[model samples]
Structures are given as structure tokens and as C-alpha cells.
Target: MKKWAIYVVLCILTPAIVKAQAVVADSVHMTSKKKVPKVQYGVASFYHNKFEGRKTANGEIFSQKKLTAACNTLPLNCWVRVTNIRNNRSVILRITDRMHPLNKRLIDLSHAAAKTLGYTGHGLTRVKVEYLGKTKPVELNLMEQPAQP
Candidate 1:
């Protein structure tokens, strides 16, 4: 009867022990290496030109000509590639500000970003966003990656 009780206890506790170990291992792995950010899809909009020269939520001056954006939850300063779903046009932008959680827009692009995606006049566009991990903000070539030899 004692052995049976011990066996039942092991069955109940082993999963919790294994899960704890796995969580620790996962955190260590994440800190040790760079990870690609996950892709997200949503509607995108451009900031009004009036917002230019105004201070952004992150303390940087907003520029209609800069390729920067606002996101609901992406970490400040993370780079993302926004692709227009209808025309397949894409532009890379850095997330420099936060969107209000109550806002319906998934992402808000700067005027330049909206122009690059060919949607400034239309106002809103459906877009797919690919998080490119954290890095210093710099404009990269928007061309597709070269095919492997």
C-alpha cells in the first residue's frame, strides 16, 4: 500500500518538476542567442503630415520622411518589415512609438513608410508585419533576399 501511494505521488509531481526545468532551460536559451521575432498581420495606417516635427511617445521628433512606425505592443526600437497585402509592396520600419490599446489600427506608419507601400492616399492598408528582432535602427535594402546558389 505504501508503494502504491508513492507511485501516485510521483505521477502527480513529475510533470510539475519537468515543466520547471524546461522553463529554466528555455530562458537560458533565449538569453544566449538572438531570436527572430514572430510575424503578425493587421491593418496599417499612416500618421498625418501634421504630426511631423512633433515629439513622439518615445521622445524622438516625428518625421514624415523617416521610416518609423507605431505598434500596439512591439518593444520600442524594434525593426519590422511591413508588407502591403494587396499589392505585395513592402517597407522596413523601426518601431519608435506605441499605439493606444483602444485604437483599432494594428500598426501606424510614418508618411514615408506609407508612401513606400503606395498607400498614403488610400489612408489604410492591410499589411503583414515580420518582426526582425532587435537591432540598431537603420534603413536596409528593401529587395528580396538573393536566392541561394
Candidate 2:
């Protein structure tokens, strides 16, 4: 009789336990979906020719010809997509430097980047900045390998 009672209790609880697990699994699946990238809208400006040879925050030599930017808040070495809202031009640039503490611009793009985005002439333009996560540093092996048998 005790065994029958235990079996009855389990039969009633089994479905509830399984249902709870399924709900948990579904919630986990929902949470595991790729999160949307963060986007920000603000004014953007480009570095001047005088800053061409300066050293960036990441120790990289700042170049007006490269697609790089100085952002006050974004992490160094991370890639970001900056779009000029006026012309709908976009450029992918690496965050290599930081902006001035008192600067109100969202990002300071390289001259080349600004040119590509069709905003170099304006000095500043409204832009949409999207955070694309950090990029992996490339490794290069220069040594020649030995011949295998």
C-alpha cells in the first residue's frame, strides 16, 4: 500500500518537474540569443593634420590615412562602425586613441575615415556609432619552418 502511494505521488509530481525543466530550458534558450549591438548617436569630428604623427592611446602611431578613431568611452583596440547620418556613409574604424576630457564630440575619427564618411569638409557631423566588439590581434610567425621527412 505504501509503495502504491509513493508511485501515485511520483506520477503526479513527474509531469510538474518535467514541465518546470522545460520552462527553464526555454528561458535559457531565449537568453542565449545573440544580444543586439549597442548604438549611439552623436556629433563626430576628425583629427587635424597636426595630429597625424602623434602617438595614440594604444601606443599606435596616429595616422590620418588609417581608419582609426579617438573615442572617449569605447575601449582601445575595439572596432566600431561610424556612420554619417547626413550622407549615410559608413566606415569601420579601430578605436586607438581617446578624446579630450572637455570635448563634447562622440568620436574623433581619422581624416581618412571622415573623408570616407563624407564629413571631412564639415569638420563635424551627426553620426551613428555602433559598438562592434574587440578585435583579435593578428599573430605573425616570421621564422622559416624546418622541412619534414
* Worst lDDT 10-window in candidate 2: 136-145
**Reference-based lDDT, each prediction:** 0.87, 0.86
Best by lDDT: 1
Residue 55 shift from truth in candidate 1, angstroms: 1.4
Clashing pairs in 1: none
Off by over 4 Å in 2: 1-37, 136-149
* Cα lDDT of model 2 by residue, 12-48, tens digit: 9999999999999999988875654479899999998
Worst 10 residues of 1 by lDDT: 136-145
lDDT of 1 by residue, 1-149 (tens): 99999999999999999999999999998886544458888999988778888888889999988989999767778888899999999988899988778999889999889999999889999999998877743446424456569
Give the TM-scores of the predictions, in the order they appear.
Answer: 0.67, 0.66
